[model samples]
Target: MDESRPTPATPPAVLADHAERMEKLLDRLLSPQTLCDEIARPERLRAAMAHGLLGGGKRLRPFLVEQSAALFHANTDAVLRVGAALECVHCYSLIHDDLPAMDDDDLRRGRPTVHRAFDEATAILAGDALLTLAFDIVSSDETDLPPTRKLALVAGLSRAAGIGGMVGGQMRDLEAEKTDRPLAIRDIEMLQSMKTGALLRYACEAGAIAAGASGDERARLRRFGEIVGLSFQLADDLLDLTSDTATTGKATGKDAAANKATLPSLHGIDWTTARLRDLVVEATDLLDPFGSKADILVQTARYIAFRDR
Candidate 1:
C-alpha cells in the first residue's frame, strides 16, 4: 500500500463509496446540460443523451468492474475510468432497449423513455454516441492501463455489447416474440447469457485485465462474473414479475405482455427464487481464494440477487 493512498474500506463502506463515486463519474461523463451553443451539436440530441444516461439506476455493471479490480489491488484511478466506460455501454443499451421498435417502453427510471422524452431519431443517435464513447473512454491514456490491457478491454466490451453479446441477445428476444412455443431452457439461457451475462463477464474480465492478473485468476473471476450475470437476470425477472412499476422505477410486467422468454417465465417464481440462492452460494464459493478481500464483491452478488431494480 502506498503512503498517500487510503487503506481498503470495509465491505459495506466500499459498496456505498463505489456507488457514490460511480454516480459522480457518470454524471461528468454524461452531463448534457454543459454543452455549448457554439458547437455544431444538436441540443436535443445532447439532452436526450443526458436524459438516458443520467437517470438514476444502481450502475451495477461498473460496480462489478470496480470491486473486482480492487480484489487484485489494481489502480483505483484506472478502475474508475474503466467503470465509467462500462457504464456508457450500459446506458446505451437501456436507451435502445426502450425504443419503440424494441421493448416499446414508455418509461425508464420512473421518467419518460428517451424516445418519448425527445424523439426516436434523437434517442437512437444518443445510444450510438454513448456506445462509441465507451470505446473512446477506455482507449484514452487517462485509464492508465498498458496498451495491451486497453486493447483487451476495448475488444471485450465490443464483443459483449455487439453481435456476440447484448445486441445479439436483443435480436433473439425480438424473434422470440413471434414464436408460438415458449423458448426451451437452453435457448433462454443462451439468450440471457448473451444479452446480460456478456457485459457482466466483461466487467469482471476488465478488472482482471486492468490488474494484469494471471490467466487462471482471470478465469476464476470470469466464472464469478458469469454467476453474477445469471443471478442478475433472475433477480430482474423476479422483479418484473412481482414488483410494480413504482417499485422498480421502470415498466413492470412488460416481459409477459411481450411474451419474452425467461427462467421465471418458464420455471415459475419458486424455482427462480431457489435458483438465485444457489447461484449466490456458487458465486461465493468461487471467491474462497480471496477470503476477506472479497467481502464487497460477495455483497455485490447478494445485492444483484435481491435488488429492487
Candidate 2:
C-alpha cells in the first residue's frame, strides 16, 4: 500500500446518481415474493419474510455487487439477481441478530424488527427460509452466470455467511459481551471484520466473478473489498458514539450497553476518524489500476466511510 494517496472526493451529484441506481435496483430485486404459490405454506412464511426484508435500508451490499459488475461491463440483471440473493442472506442475519436472544432490538430500517412484527417462531423460520433460499437463488437454473463461475460465487458466499465468517463473528460478539472483556483495538477490528465485513467482501467478489473478471482482477477486488468492509464497520462504530437514534435509524449507544468493543469506544473518536480516512485512501488506491472505469466504486468506498447515515 502506498504511504500516501489522496482519497477521491465523491461528488454529491455522483453520489446521488449512485444512490438512485442503488435504490432502483434494490426495489426491483427485493420486489419479488419469496414464497411462491406452489409452495404449500407460502402465505405465513411470506409475511414473516417480508416483515424484515421489505421496507428500506441503505442496500449497500447489493449496491456493491452491482457497481463491481459495472466495473467489468457485465450484465446488470445477472448481477442484480445475485446481489438480491446476497441481500436475502444479509436480511436473514439481521433478523436473527435482532432476536431477543441476540441484539434484542425492536427496530430496523424504521420498522419493527422481525420478531416484533411477527411471532418469534415465525421470525426464526423466516430467517431460516431466507438463508436456504439465498443459496437456492444463486444455484437455480435461472441464474445467468456460467456454470463454473456460478459455482464459485455460491461457494464464496456460503463461506462468508457460514461458520468461519458472519455466524462465527456473531458468536464471538456474544461471548465478548458475557465476559465483559475490554478488547484490544485489533481484536475489535477482527470481530467486526469477521462479523460484518466478511459478507460485504463476498458481495463485491461475487459481482466481479459474475462479470467473468480475470484472476488478477478478482484478487485486486478482494483486497479492495476487505479494506472497504473494515472501513464500513469502523464508520458504524463511530456513528454509534456520535449519532442519535433518529439519524442512525436505529438505537444509538447500543454498542456501549451491550459492552461491545467498537472503533470509537476503543480508540477514541479522533483516532478512529483518522483511521477511517486512511482506509478510504487505501481502498481508493487499490482501484487505480482500473483507472477511470472504477471512479464510481472508489467514490462509493469513500462514501461508505464518511456518510452520516
Candidate 3:
C-alpha cells in the first residue's frame, strides 16, 4: 500500500496545499458537533478556543507529521487526524504561553492573544480544553488506529508535551530569565530541546508509530526531528533579531529584552546561520534511504531553517 508517488508540484506548493487542507480540517474538528455533545460545550469557552486554535500559523509541525507518515505510506485519513491532534497541543501551548503569567505577549498569529481577546480565566480554560482534546482525538475511535498504536501515540505525545519535556523546559527558561547570569550553551540547548523541540520531535516519531515503521527508521526520523527542532529555534531567534512584528505576525526583539539565551543570541548571526545550514544538510542526509519520496520533508527542513516568520 505504498502511496508514495512522484509529485510534480514544488515543495512550497505541496506545503501550501497541506496547510490549506489542515486548516479546513481544524475548522470542522472544532465545530460543536465534532467536539462534544451540544449541551457540554459552553458558548464563550468554545469561542475562545476557536479564536486561539483557528488563528493562522504555518502549521509546520503537522506538516512534519503528514510528510513523515507518507514515508511509510500510512493511512492518509488516520495521519491527518494525528496531525490535528498534534496541532491541538501546539495551539494549547501558544494560548498558555501568551497568558499574563508566561511570556505576557499581546499578539499571536496577527491577532489578539486569547487572554487579551477573552478573559484570563476563559483563556486558561480554552488552553486546558485544547490540551485535553488532543488526547481525546488520538485515543478516540475516529483516528482509525489500532489500540496498541493509539496507546503508543498517547504516551509519546504526553512525554513530549508534559513535564520532563516542554513543560520542564519552560520552567528552566523561566528560571534562567530570573537569574542575572546567562545560561551556558549546554543548558540552553537542553532548555530549547525540551521547550520547543519536544513536540516537534514527537511529530515525526508519532508518524512512524502510526505507520508501524521499524525501530531503526523510527529512530532516524526522531533524530531528524531533533535536528529540525534545533534549526527551527535558531531561525526563530534570528527572526526575532532581524524581522519586525509586521512580518512575523508577532512581537519581535522580546528575546533580548527578556535576556533569553538563544543560540543566535549566544553565537553571532553568521555562526547561527552556518549552523542552520549544517543542520539541514544533516537532516536531509538521514532521509536518503527514502529517495525522492522524502523530497517534501527535505524541502521542509530547509524551510524550517530559513523561514522569515
Measured by lDDT, the strongest candidate is 3
lDDT of 2 by residue, 1-309 (tens): 333322323433444454466556445434444345444656777778877776666677877887788888884667877877888899999999999998888888768898998879989999998888788778877778889988998899989998889998999888787785587877777788889989889888887899999998898888788888988887788788888988767678978886777778877877877788888788888888778988878888888887775
Better of 1 and 2 by lDDT: 1
lDDT of candidates 1 onward, in order:
0.83, 0.79, 0.88
lDDT of 1 by residue, 18-137 (tens): 778887877776554433343666767777878888747767788889888888998588888898888889989999999988888897767899999888999999999888888988
TM-score between model 2 and native: 0.89
TM-score of each: 0.88, 0.89, 0.93
Judge candidate 1 at residue 134 and give its lDDT. Answer: 89
Over 4 Å off in model 2, which ranges?
1-34, 37-39, 245-249
Error of 2 at 212 (Å): 1.0
Cα lDDT for residue 52, candidate 3: 92
Give residue 74's error in model 1 in angstroms: 1.6
